[model samples]
Target: MAGHRNIGSAQSQSFSKAERLNSKKLMDELFNKGSSFVLYPFRVYWMKHEQPVPSKVQVLISVPKKNFPLAVDRNRIKRLMREAYRKNKFLIIDSMNGNEKNLAVAFLFTGKNLSPQNLTPNPSLKQRGMATQKKSSVKNLPQYKLVEEKMIEALNQLSKNSLK
Candidate 1:
């Protein structure tokens, strides 16, 4: 009998190491000189990487220490942001792919600090949905469709700026 192996869907959905913005100099430029747009809770900073790179885009997500005094809250917000970006990044990546350019981007979570109750799990959630996790709920996430739309708008803005 032939062996059955599990499909590597996690790898396909994962944010690989190569797609992370880890360079010090690049990050400095991305913050100091990059263009930004605010979509309520998410502030996106993005710039075309000056140096050539194989990856279409690299992303960094941050939830400020000032806003989230507890590490758990900060980490949870970051996890949600990453989940949103990983699932929706194709909107930007598809555009960049056609033009063959590399982009470095940072997404900062700017939402107000919530009371612990606001971050608690909702018992009614289904197991696997874009906006919820199995153990904990990503409460207060902008709807997945809205997040994707915002990403697309930001990328469109980036392209327009590039033309000028």
Candidate 2:
């Protein structure tokens, strides 16, 4: 069973510690000097480093405490962001691999908590004259699909920018 395991598959999708941007000095430099662009839910900041590094790209994911007051909410958003990046990071990484410069990137969550707008009431409920109370719904939570889509787009955009 062990011998049959697909090592390439696991390694391709792995988000190792080396990929995380954790240095305070580097973080500050990235935020202060990096160029940025808004892609709806995320504001991406990226800078190319002249120095050589083992990892082609380092990423930092942030969910603002002000937008997500609860620790659980912030953590969930961050998790989603990280997962999205982990899955689609090859869009940027593969492009950067041959380049001499290393990249530092940060993905900041800019959108508010997602909640479905009840613009039109259900016809059946309206006809029955039942009150539509706003209860906590799964629709209000962040979605992986949306996050992954945005992450893919952001990585593509970053790769394009890096080429120039």
Candidate 3:
């Protein structure tokens, strides 16, 4: 049974408390000294951990109240971000496993409200007194598939950066 492995225990795709960045001090340091890059809907901040951490990678997901005024909307966005991260975190984990460095990352939601109704009218159209019509083909990307795709891309980018 040397080669046999339990599929269920092989990879835990769970977002555990241990993998959450919760320390105010560490968070302050990460914000103050971390390198950041914008990946469309997310502004990612990451720093190599100075202290030994239980997990190889820890993450914080933030949805700004300014962008999403409603609590429900913010919560939903956070949930989607969390789910996407939970499923794809192995991208970072596997990349970092060989290295001694532990990583702390923050994912800030930078996109405007995803709801079509909340979309702001074009300033030129507003100034010209032209009606702004919503396009039927343009749908909100609150769906899991779209969010997951972005998450995967972000993680892949971060992994590449971490290698440097």
Candidate 4:
């Protein structure tokens, strides 16, 4: 958490446990074929299907290089996203605990570059026709605010739904 933003409150720190999923088979089983829950910019796809004691949550954060060519930018965004999730995912954990449900979550980055300055249909298009055009990379894409809001909303809804 060095050089990370500490914006959330203490109540958002309940999810402190970190469990590792070492086996590729396990990861595939959980993430590859699992029920998905979509919030918005963040998609939570998980299931109650795992071996051994189901007391832990395995998570993965993704930042598509196709969307963000710069590895530095992608890594930075992923770090921020993970930090945000680590700070906020406690709500979902508590709700899941209360509901007695085991889960596996993956935080995927589906953000696209839609800046007004670079409003082209293709961000990776190098040539338009015969002349050869310059392909402008993704510039000034939308921030992850909506992703955070949608995560909160998803957690809140998960809490509500757990009551039933």
Rank list by lDDT: 3, 2, 1, 4
For residues 1-164, write the lDDT of model 3, one tens digit per residue: 89553333367989999999988998999999999999878999999875877788999999887776657667877999999999888888888888888899999989864555434334654566443444321223366666788899999999999999
What is the per-residue lDDT of model 4 for residues 1-164, given as tens digits with 9 covering 90 to 100?
79574444444453344543455766688677776666655566555643664355556677877778768667767876766666677666666654445566666777664446433333344354422533333344445564466667766665554445
The residue ranges of model 2 lying beyond 4 angstroms of the native Cα positions read: 1-11, 115-139
lDDT for each residue of candidate 1 in 26-48, tens digit (9 for 90 to 100): 89999999988786667888887
Q: Considering lDDT, which of the candidate structures 3 and 4 is the better prediction for this target?
A: 3
Per-prediction TM-score to the true structure, in the order listed = 0.67, 0.78, 0.78, 0.63
Per-candidate alpha-carbon RMSD to the true structure:
9.1, 6.9, 8.1, 6.9
- Lowest summed lDDT window (length 10), candidate 2: 131-140
Candidate 4, residue 62: the lDDT equals 78
Among residues 3 or more apart in sequence or in different chains, the pairs in candidate 1 whose N, CA or C atoms overlap within 3 Å are none
RMSD of 4: 6.9
List pairs with backbone clashes in candidate 2. Answer: none
Q: Please give the distance, in angstroms, between residue 134's alpha carbon in candidate 2 and its true position after superposition.
A: 13
Tens-place lDDT per residue, model 2, 1-164, is 75352333234777889999888988999999999999988999999987555587999999887776667667877998999998788778778868888999999998875545412223664556553544312214467888888898999899999999
Q: Would you give me the overall lDDT of model 4?
A: 0.59
Model 2 TM-score?
0.78
Candidate 3 C-alpha error for residue 94, in Å? 0.2
Q: lDDT of each prediction vs. the true structure?
A: 0.67, 0.79, 0.81, 0.59
